[model samples]
Target chain A: MNADPTRLLAREMAARLRTGETTARALAEAHLDAAERQNHALNAWLVIDRDGALRQADAADAVLAGARRDGPGALAALHPLLGIPVGLKDLISVEGGQCTAGSRILEGYRAPYDAHIVERLRDVGAVFLGKTNMDEFAMGSSNEYSAFGPVSNPWDLDTVPGGSSGGSAAAVAAHHVPLSLGTDTGGSIRQPASLCGIVGMKPTYGRVSRYGIVAFASSLDQIGPFARDARDAAALLHAVAGRDARDSTSAPVPVEDELLHLPESDDEAVAWLRGRRFGLPREYFVAGMDPDVERRIHESVAFLVDAGATVEDVSLPHTDYGLATYYIVAPAEASANLARYDGVRYGLSRRLEGGDFIADYLATRGEGFGAEVKRRVMLGTYALSAGYYDAFYVKAQKVRTLIKRDFDEVFASGIDALVAPTSASVAFRFGARMTDPVSMYLSDACTLPVNMAGLPGVSIPCGLSEGMPVGLQLIGPAWSELMLFRAARAFEGLTAAATWRNLEPAQLAEADDAAGPTPAERAAALAAAR
Target chain B: MAGLSRSDVEHVAHLARLGMTTAELDRLEGQLNHILEQYMKLAELDTDAIPPTAQTIELENILRDDVATPSLPASAVLGNAPAREGDFVIVPPILGGDAG
Candidate 1:
C-alpha cells in the first residue's frame, strides 16, 4: 500500500480514475495504507476496513470500465465521489459498525440502520473507511473530552487539532484520507479544521440530513464535511446533500451538483464576489486575539481585496453574547436529547437489586459519563429546571434570536458573506488550556456565531502564525453555500502557492520530546486515556 | 460565585451520574461555579416581550413524512453490542451480574 495522494483534490482524484490515469482499487489501497500509517500517530481512525474498502474499490473499477466502454450513462451513473474513500465521525450511526460517539457508555453499541447521509454516500459509491473520534457526545470544544483520547494536530504533534471534529480534521490534514464527514453543533467542524489547517464546511442548518446522527442538540447539529480544500468540501456537500424522509429536518430542496464543476471564467467568478458584499463584523476582533493571528487575518482581507471582493466594517452587536447563549441553549437541549441514555432502554444498564428503580438510574448514569460531559449536563438541567427556566434558559433563547437577527441585519445590508479569524490563535499545545474550560470555550469565540445564527460557514487555510496554520472563516446566510464557496475559492486561488509550505510533520521519533510522547505512543496513550 | 460547597458538587455529580473522588469533586465544584457565574450576566438584559427562540432559524414543522424506510437487518444493528440477551440489549449489572 502506498501513502495517500497528497494535495490532490477529491474531484481531481476521481476524474483521474475515470480517465484511466489510475485505478480506483489502487487509490483506495493507497488511502487505506496511509490511514493505517497515520492512524497510529494521529489517533484519527476508530476502525480500518482493509477487506471492505478493496471490495468497493474493485466494484468501482468494474463500473467505471463498463461506463468507459459504453460511453457515459451506459453503466449506472453515480456521483463523482463514487467509490472514493471517506471517514465518518463516530457520533453518527452507520448500519453495521460501532457508533461510539467517543464514549465508553456506547463502547460496543451499533446502529440498526444507516444514517440518512450514510445511505446517500452509499448511493453515490463513497466507501466508508472508518469512524473518526469526537468530543464525547459532541459536548466539548476540545476533542480532549472524548473517551477515545485527544486527536493530535498532524501539522505539529504537540498542538491540538480542534474539536469535536478534531479527528476528522487531523485525518484529512495528515493526508490519511482526502475527505471525511463531521458534524457542527457549534464550531465542531470549522474550529478543528482551522486548527489543523484544512477546509471544513458546515452547511446551512438543514442542508444536510441528521436522521441517524445521535442527538446532542438536535436543533443545532448539522452534518458537514472536512476535506483537503474547499472544492472537495463542496463536492462532499453535493454528494451527500438534500432532503431525506429519514431526516425530517433535511431541507426540502432539489440537490445541486453545480458546485462540483464551477466555471473557471474569472468574470463570472469575480462577479459573484464583487457584486456581493463581504461583511467584517466588528465584534469578532476579540480582545485576546494573538497579534500574529490578527496580522494573518488582515492579510486574508488583503488577499480577498486582491480577488475583487470588497469588505466593509459591519456590526453584529449581539456577537459578544454568542458563547453564553450557546452554552445555555445547547445544554438545555442536550439534557432533553440525552435523556434517552438512561439505564433502562439502552447503554450500560446497572441493576440495583435492593434499591428502587430511581436508585438504579442514578447509579447507572453516575458511572457512564466523563467530568466535562457531566458538568454540562448538570448546568443544562439546572437551566431548564423549574423556577430557573425563565431566567437562564428562556433568556438565553431570546438572546439567540437577537443573535440571529444580527446576522439578518448584516445580510440585509447587502453583504454576500462575512470573514474573520477562525480562532483567537493558532493551535495550542496539549494541556496548555485543557484544565481551563472557559479558555477552551473561548477558542471557539469567532466560529460559534455562525452556528448560533444557523448559517453556512467554511474555514480555509489563510496564512501562518508563529509557524502554525491560521484560517479565515467565511460565513454566508442560510443556504448560501455556493456563494461562500466562490468567495473562498477566489481567495484560495491567490494564496494557494504560499502558506502551508512549511507545515512538514516531524516524524514521531524526531519530534521535540517536550511535546509529549512519540506520535505512536501518543496515539496509544489517547486510546488508553479514553 | 466561584466557590461551590461540597454538597452542591455532590448534588450536581448525582444529577450528572458521575462518581468523583474528594479531590476531583473539590476541583470541579470550584470550576463549575466559576463557569456558571459567567452565564449569570444574561440576567441583566430585559427580554420581556421577546419570544424565546429555540432554533436560530424559524423553520417550523420541518419534519419528514412518517414513512417506513429501508433498514439493515437486526443482526447488523446488534453486531457490536458489548452484551445482549436474545433480541434485547444487555448491560452490566448495577448490583450483581445475575440481575440481567
Candidate 2:
C-alpha cells in the first residue's frame, strides 16, 4: 500500500492485491489520476470511463475480499488481473462504450455488444480504464490519421508512437495503464510498441476472435497486447485467445501457458536459447534505415549469439512485393468490410440536399471518411472494379502465396524463428512520413510480410538507439507463440545487463526531458501548428 | 498513362458511393495513381501456375447446428443508428427522384 501501483507491473500490482495490501479501487483510482494528468499532452486516451472503471474495480475488490476469507491460496486463485486497469484500442468494441476506430465515419457511435476479448477481460477481472486513440479505421502508420488526434510517444513528444495502435502503446509507455489491447493488421500493434519502447505481440491470425473488432483487412488483422514485459504480454494473450462461436475464424486450439515455461534464472534462460536456431533475412537489414536502429538490432542478435544461438542468413525473397501486395489486398477487403457504413445503418451520415439514395450514400461516405481512409478505400475499390480484378487483387494474392512460401522454406530449413528489426527507424518527427503515401506504406516494411504469411511475430524492446528504443522482431511459423515467447523472454533477460529493467518510458520521460520538452514532448508544441 | 482522369475518378467515386468534390477528386486521382504505380511490381513475379490465396488457412464452410441462439435485441442494435423510427433506420426518401 505504501508504493504507487503505477510503478508496478500488472502482475506485481495483483500480487499486492492478493495480500490485501491495496484494493482494486485504489489502484484504479491511481491509474485514472495518471491518465488525467498525461492524456492532455500525450493524446493517448480517447475516452476515460472513471465511473465505469471504478464500478468494475469495486466489484473486483468485493471478489478479493470474499476470497480473502478463505486464505492467501484462495486469493491467488483470483490472479493479478483482478482490477488491473487495461486500455482498449478504440477499434475494439466495449459494449455501450464509444468504438470509433478513429474515423469520423463512426463518430458518435457506440458498440452494441462486447467484443469476444471484452467478454474475456470481464471474466478475468481486468478493469477497462478507457479507449485509446488510433489511426482512423486502422489505415495509417503515423497515428496522425486519427479523427480524434495523434498519440505522442512518451519517449519524445514530437515523434509519433507509430500506428494504428499508437494510443494503446503510448498509454502503456506513459504508465497510464500497465496493459492495453491493440489490433494489428499491418504492424499496427508491434510497430507502435517498437517506437514507444514496450512489448507487443500479434497472435497468429485467427488466434484471437475478431467478432466485435471493426474489420479493416479481415485476412491480416489480429488483436494483441502491449505490456512492459514478455510475461504480461503472454498473460494478456492467454486471457483473450480462445474459440468463440461468434468468430468462425477463431482458432480451436488451446491457449498454451507460454509464461509458465520461462526460466527463473539468467543461466537457464541462456541455455534455453542455445538449442534454437535463428534466421536473419538480408532484405530486412537493407540500406536507408537508421544506422542506430540497425546497430541496436544487431547488438541484440549478438546477445543471442552469446546465449549460444546459431545465427544464419535467410531470404524471404518476396519481401519487396509485400508492401505493394498488402496495399492491394488490404484495401480490397477494407472496401468490402466498410460497405455497411452507409449512413442508413449507423455512424456519421451527411445527408445531401437531395432525396436520391445515391446522393445520400455519396455525401455520407465522402464527408465522413478522412483523407487516408478515402485514399485506401478508393485504391481498394479500383483494384476490385471490373477489368482490374485479375491484374490487381488476384495478382496480389498470387504474390501472397509466394510470400508465405518464403517463410515455409525457412522454417523447413530448421530455423526455429526469424529475428530482425521490428521497424526501419525509431519514431520519426510528426509529418516525417505523412507527406508521401508510398513513404507511409514503407513504414510497415519490416512487419507486414509476416502478416502476408499469416505468421506470429513479436516485437520486444532490445535497447536504446540514440535514446529512442529499438525493437527486435521474432517471428515463428504458424502456431509458434510458445517458442516465440520463450526466445523473446531470453532476449528480454539479456537487456538487464544494459540497465533495461529501468527503461519504462513513463518513468524515464521525466528525467529524459531536458531543453524545452524532450524530443518526445515536441508533439504538444506541434499541435498548435496543425 | 496510369494516372486517372477527372471523369475516371468521378466514375469510380460513383461506383464506391463516395461524393468527392473537384478538389478531392483531383488530389485523389494523383495519389491513387501513385499508389497503383507501386503495385506494378507484382507483374515481375511469374504466377502462371500458382493459384491466388483467397484465405490464409485452408477453410471449409463452417457448419453449426441450424438452431437459433439468443441474438442482440433490436434496441441494442438500433441504439447507434443516427436517425431511427421504430426498429428500422430512417433514410432519405429514395424514389423522390430529384435533387432539391
Candidate 3:
C-alpha cells in the first residue's frame, strides 16, 4: 500500500529490472549477497549457487538487452519472471542440479534432466538460487524433518516457519528470493505460507506439472508459487503453469494471463452476497481450534461480507474422515513411491556379504530412511498389505471420494467458493508437536479437505493472533483457480492490516540464539516447522 | 492391534535402517502403536458404495503423443554418479561385500 521501493512486490522488482532501473545481474548479486548473509541465521537454503547464479543473471542481462533492441522475445522469452531469482524446493528436479529432496538417501543425486517447471523457468531466464530445505520426501507438515537441517522461522526463531515447504516460505518471507516454488500435499505449501505470513497457492490438482517433483503423495502433490502477494503469484503461475508432456496428469489447458493489467482495489474486501455465496464448513471448527483463530475467521468473514459476498453455514459431515483418509492414501502412495530408494540402483548402499537379495533390500532401506519416513512407509506398506488392502487402503480411497463429493455438493449449491481458517490455530513453538504424532496430523484438518477434493486453494494473510500470522483459506472448484485467485485477492485487498506481510532478520537471530538444545540436524528438520 | 513386540520392532528397524538401541526401539514401538491406533478411525466409516479416488481431477487420456525428443548425452546422465564404471552408473554393490 505504501510507495516504498524497498517493500515493492516481485512484479514491481521485475518491472524495474526490465526498465533498466536495476540490471538483472545487479539484482541477482544483491539477493545472493543477502541470502549468504542471512543463511547462517535462516538456514533456508540447502545450496546457494553463487557462480551458477551470476552466470545465469549475466545471461538474463544479455537477453534483456537483445529484447530491448528487438521486442520482448517470444512468450517463452517475454515471460514475467525472466530474470527473477527463484529458490526451488529440492523435491522438484532441475537438470544438472543437486536434487536431494532434503534426504540422505537422495544426497548427491543430480537430476539428468530438468523438471517440466524447471524447463519453463530456465527457458524464461529465471536465475536458479539452488534448492531450499523441505520435509524429506514432502511427508511432514512442518519442515522439522529435513535431512539438511531445520529452517528457522523468519519471524521468530523460537517458533517454526511451517513445513514441508517451510524453507520456501521463509526464503520468500525474509526477502532472500522474491519467488519460490513448493509442493503442497496435505497443506505442505499453504500451512507453511500461512505460518510464515506470505502468499501461497495450491492450484487445483493437475494445474501444475508434477513430472519431476519427488513423490510424497503423488495424487496430492501440486507445485505452486510462494510470493509476496497474489498478483505476483499469478504472474509466476503464468510463466511456469500449464501442461507438460512429461506429466500426463498435468492439465491440458493454456496458462492463464490472469494478472495482466489488473485493476487496483482500495477497499479491502466487500463480501458481496448479492449472487455470490460463501460456505463455512462446520467440520473445520473443531474442538482444539484456538479461540483466537476462530475470532480471526469471524473477522475475515465479516470483511468478505462487507466486500459483498454472501455467507452461510454449511455441513461437510465427511470432513471428520479427511485426516484418516489422508494418512492412509498418502502413505500408500508414499510406500509405492519410496520403493525406488533401495540402495541397489540409487541412494545409500551399505556393505554386506553373502546376503540374500531381499536381505540387502531390507538393510539398505532400513539405513537410508529416517524415522518419520520409515513410519509412513511402514504404515503405507501395512495398509496396502494383501489381506488388509480391501479393508484399509480401499476403504480410505472410498472415504476420499466422499470428501470430494462434500465439496462438489456445496459448489453445486451455488456457492462460488468456500472459506475456512487455513489451520485450526496459529503456528506453535518448535517442539510443540514433536512427540504428538496424532495431534500433529490433526493440524492439517482445515487444509487437507481441499486437496482431497482437488480444488484450488489460496491462503492469504487474514488476521493475526498472539503476534503470529493466521491465514484465511479460500477454496474454489476444480479448474476454478481464477475464481479462487479473484476471491482471495479481494479479501487480501480488504484486509488493511500488514500483520502477515514480512519477517525481519532480527526475529530469526533471536530465535536461533535463544537458549535451547541445538535443533535436529536433518531428519527431524524436514517436516515443515510452522 | 497392540504395542509392537521387540522382534517386530527390530524387524521394522531392520527395514528402516538406522542402528537403534533397545531403548530407542521400545520408545518407537510405543509411538508407532499410538499413531496406528489413532489412524484406525478410517475403519469406522462405511464407504461401501463410494468409489476409491486415486486422483481428484477428472482428465482423460493422459498419454502424450509419441514423439522422438532430443535425449540427454550419456556423459551428463552419468556425470554426477558417485561411483561410475565406464558407460555404466556404478553403485556400491547390492550384495555389498567390498569395492567391486
lDDT of each: 0.78, 0.86, 0.77
Clashes of each: 7, 6, 50
Model 2 misplaced regions, further than 4 Å: A504-530, B96-100
- Evaluate residue A21 in candidate 3 and report its C-alpha lDDT on the 0 to 100 scale: 79
Report the interface RMSD that candidate 1 achieves against the true structure, in angstroms.
4.1
TM-scores for every predicted model:
0.91, 0.95, 0.91
Q: Distance from true position, residue A508, model 1, in Å?
A: 8.6
Worst 10-residue stretch by lDDT in candidate 1 chain A?
A: A506-515
lDDT of candidate 2 over A107-145, digit per residue (tens): 899899999999999997899999999999999898989
For candidate 1, write residues B1-100 as lDDT tens digits. Answer: 2345778768766665555667777777777777887787776667787777766555568655678877666666565554577777665445643575
What's the true lDDT of residue A269 in model 1?
54
Query: What level of docking quality does candidate 3 show?
Result: acceptable
Q: Kindly report which residue pairs in candidate 2 clash with one another.
A: A156-A520, A157-A520, A157-A521, A157-A523, A158-A522, A158-A523
> Chain A TM-score of each model, in the order shown?
0.93, 0.96, 0.92
| Candidate 3 per-residue lDDT over residues A391-503, each given as its tens digit | 77888889989999989999899888888889887777766777777777877888888888888898887767877788888888888777777776777677655544444
> By TM-score, is 1 or 2 better?
2
Model 1 reproduced share of reference interface contacts: 0.38
